[model samples]
Target: MNEHDLRHLEIPLPFAPQRHSMSDRAQERVQIWAMRFGLLADDAAARRFESLGYARFSAYWCPTASFADMLLVAEWITLFFVFDDLQNQAITTGRLEDYDRLRHTALQVVYERGVTGPVPPVIAALSNLCTRTFPRNSVAWQRRFELNLELWLIGHARENSFRQAGRSPGPAEYPRLRRDASTVLPTVDLAEVIEHTELPDALYFGPSYQEIIATTADIMCLTNDLHSLAVEYDAEDTINMVTTLRDHRGMNLSEAVAEVRRLIDVRIADSQAAAQSITAEMDALHLPPRIRNGVRRCIRDCQSAMAGMELWDRTETVRFTPDEELGATRAIDYNNGFLDASELGRAAPADSRRV
Candidate 1:
């Protein structure tokens, strides 16, 4: 509730920190890419976007990726930030129709590829991303990524419905919704792509692996809610867990913050245990050395992602800071006529040989 409570709150994460060697190059590439798609209005807007440290964030999550893969990962993170801001604006302004339309456009871009006709800058950028990245991975990975993306979009709609009704989700219902809405699952899927490895369907959907992913999502959502608490509270956004706990669970501000922090700790512990369980299960299965190593690497990637996100939030990103302090100029309006539709089109079909 108070700045002091948030400032003093510490969420412990056990993973060691790491950063990509190509982070600076990746950052520069993403800025240019964003400008090409009209996501950044001008030099000033580009600078503001850079100040957000998205490239560093991506680098932390994917420290071992090649330069090309790192750039793709950074681009995805940048797109997520832009999409989140635009969606938040739509929901806050009660523009549910626009929000729904944006969701549909995004889904279409991923599902159909090379979407023709004019679209918003974000959608256009997404189409470009999919065209460039999808062919590098397997059909199975693509399908998994698409499903997670759909869940994330649907989760936004669910949150918007609560906002339109002027109500917060009950505490019991929030965790499930937050997991999908956080978009962490897709990022996890991206890890597999970046590593050029895939888990068999059975291992991926197993209880232990699923638990690890769910706990990671919970940790991410709760950590974000805590860091952005002051900003969201100032904006009167009631969708965050802290707000939900305070309003729906009848807890005071201090109590709510403490409770959310407590929940994060619990989830972190659960995530570690799940990781251990999955490793043991893999050993028990006596899988081939290659498959075992791939699975283990994937698990490490998820832990790295969690740690990377926390480190970026704490040290690099200016997102939780006030706009005035950062001299931020561009607003989150994707329909402001800045997008050029000339280059927008459907991507070529997926190469069946990529898998």
Candidate 2:
């Protein structure tokens, strides 16, 4: 197979003797697949990723996790994986003009939203990965890496669009979204990955789901921040993700509500646009029905979520404070630091390059 085909590939379980227990054996399978394909980061990094929750929800291979509460998480990830696969293909001698359009559209979103609109870590890491895999100046390598980064940013916004759309109001043009993949790979033993990174368990949830509900939760957690960007943006340094905006004005009660409404409007437009794009693609090319259906569901669900999300208000947050600002501020500051690290190149000042 070509390199593009291998972009999101998973390895088969590694071989070991001594009759490991079922769970350990299962975990070994996860390792085998991850290591063979390079998914297994250093143990400490993995730990950080898991500790931070990246592993819990985004380990795409283990299907047992559910996303019911946050079904969009699963959709966004599934979408990310697909986009990654497609980008790999594009970079590896497969080009689709529409993809360029998509990438630009996403960049537009980020530009409009400003610095807080994007995250960069995955792109940077993937670029580093590409440098290791292909010769410098390889168009395939450059495009492939570029596309992955773009998709991650777009996925960041898209997932929120799904959440803001909320649960279906019952059989609109697009039905509510759901996934049964978690049933495919139920147990994701991440101990090995945890040891390698500082990523934290939230990453695990991004890819962990035993059923659809859990998968959705994972997906939602990843994207819900966009819908609740207000919460994350305006929250005290103790618990906010949009740190640049943490001290910025306009995050107060009334303004936050207004932003939600405005975001929902944009999401609705996005939903319509994505659907149109997919439908146009369908006119000439044939794709797996499952993917088409999945796209349809994600589009509809996210649109609905966006609508309901407009109702999100500052009231949802607890405003009580201690006599003075406490160390709790670091909770969000730390997460933001991680996010900045994740952005491709210098989402913040300290985001220096590392192998």
Candidate 3:
């Protein structure tokens, strides 16, 4: 890959995203449910959460779905953040075994309906989400989510192992890990849930539709990798695409970031094309109006999610801030410091980096 001097880049977004009305009520519901679910560990955690601005983040993740469904989306988004935070802590603190046990226990809560005894707050929250989300959806849909959740936790475990061993994934291996490591797949599952559309297995598994799903997931992961690059660098995390390209491909930081941006455009274009193919296929089938509408809604939800991800990053979120916006109010180390391109020269190589 040819290196580009992208250290001081301000690349424009390559796609036009649909706009959805954001609800403060939905954001507030996330905060309320977050507390009820024991999403925070303590007062200190709460303070740190405020600095992270997850309420706004959750709002962005949820589209213009109904109020009830938005509530569900908000809760799900909050639960994911809670789970991710705990998992990251485990990895950073060298508690991989504890993280594994925690995920296994959480999966138990998800699978066993009656095993509702005491568990960790994150597990309890997930149990509630699974119980609430599964009943309205198909068993197959629930299974998809269960498998995706499994993959997510497994990816986290893999990352934890890497962290323990001081290893960073190469470019070839990074995307596979990212598919599970990030919430990309789960977010697709959420799109189905939020749309209240159980897409027929035939359409969902078809090559063109699957392309849409994969491309959309890639877009989500790349968008996040771009927006969160600074924060991840600040935390010395190596799971980001930027770092992976730089380390494995011998590109500089600027080149890696530019490549990530280019990949974002490519994925978005592929997703758009796949979406058109899906529409054409739906037309050819001449399916029932209900099924056709549901399929369209599912595709729309995925597009809306992509738009949300893009819009959220450009906003004043705590995770992606300008260099002048230094000095966090809370006492937290995870991406709590300022970052600029100048810091790249001072950054250690991939092997020396750890979260």
Candidate 4:
């Protein structure tokens, strides 16, 4: 996509509510599940969860879900963050071998249940999620989700290898790795489970439909990289879109941030176009009314994901703030919203949270 010369850019917001009404229920579920998974094993762990705002983060994914489904989805999101926090610690501590072992153990728990041994909290959480969420799902859906999770881990390992060798990925290579590493696909996959409707294989695997999901992932990844750029930079992490662009394209930080914003807008436009095209194809296709409705619902869920997540990124979480102190609360300047050119900076200030 060509970078447009523009004075200001507005990131799209979800027309629907950013969160479900059962905020209290969602919060309680996260707490109970965190305890069950041993994520709140100590004061330090409890403090970290409090700082991350897991409940706030969970509310953003599906705004209209039933309380039961919302609880499942929130716990699922918790599983991701807990796993992510553990991996970040592993990487920060230079425990690459331990990280590898953790990956192996988690995957085994996901794919080969009933393995006898003590399971860690992360894996325990994952195992519980798999049983609760996937029992009635299609084998194909299960496999797709499994592959997405596996690829995410693989991407992290690949990025770690580059760090170990003191190398930076070129602009092209970075997106390829980031797509999987970002774990957007599996996140989007939840639209099916929470909505309780599956897109049939023919529609799901169609070119236009796949494009819609990929563009959704692309949009999410760009927004995330931009949001987290400052934090990653502060940590001296090189495996990020901003850093990759600066190193590979020889641009300064401002140039990279601008380019990434342009890319996010471009992906948003592309996903809209793809959604329209897929809808037309669905209308033209002669299918059972139920199946047709399922496809339509699936499409709507994809759109909801974009809006929900955009709202969450801008308003809910402290994961991308400039301050290292995670416990402090921050206010969101929606007027100075995400993708606004005027708000562009190395990172959101300690006072302002941005997507």
Best by lDDT: 1
lDDT string for model 3 (102-159, tens) is 6666555555531354444565567667667767778787787777777877888787
The TM-score of candidate 2 is: 0.30
Spell out the clash pairs found in candidate 4.
Answer: none
- TM-score for each candidate, following the candidate numbering: 0.90, 0.30, 0.83, 0.82
| Tens-digit lDDT track of model 4 for 58-135 | 665677778887788788777676656656666666777766766766666556532333355555566667666666
Residue-pair clashes per candidate, as listed?
3, 96, 0, 0
Candidate 1 vs candidate 4: the TM-score winner is 1
lDDT of 3 at 278: 82
Candidate 4: stretches off by over 4 Å: 1-17, 113-116, 283-285, 324-355
The residue-by-residue lDDT of candidate 2 on 1-355, one tens digit each, is 3212221222111111111123223333333333333333456433322222222233222222232212223223323433333343333332434334434443432222222224433333333333332232234323433443444445433433333333211112111221111111111121111111111222222221112223232333213333334323332211121222223433544443344335434434443444455554543345456545544443333333222222221111111112132223212111111222223343322122222
RMSD of 3: 9.8
Over the stretch 1-355, how does candidate 1's per-residue lDDT look in tens digits? 4743463245678876578888888888998888888777776677677787787788876878888988888898888878788777776666677667667767867886546454667877887887877777778878888899899899988887887787789999999998988888888888877888777777778888899889988987888888777667766776889889878879888888789978988988898889888877777667678877777777777787787777676667777764554565435454352223333343233343111
Ranked by lDDT, the better of candidates 1 and 3 is 1
Give the per-residue Cα lDDT of candidate 4 at 28: 70
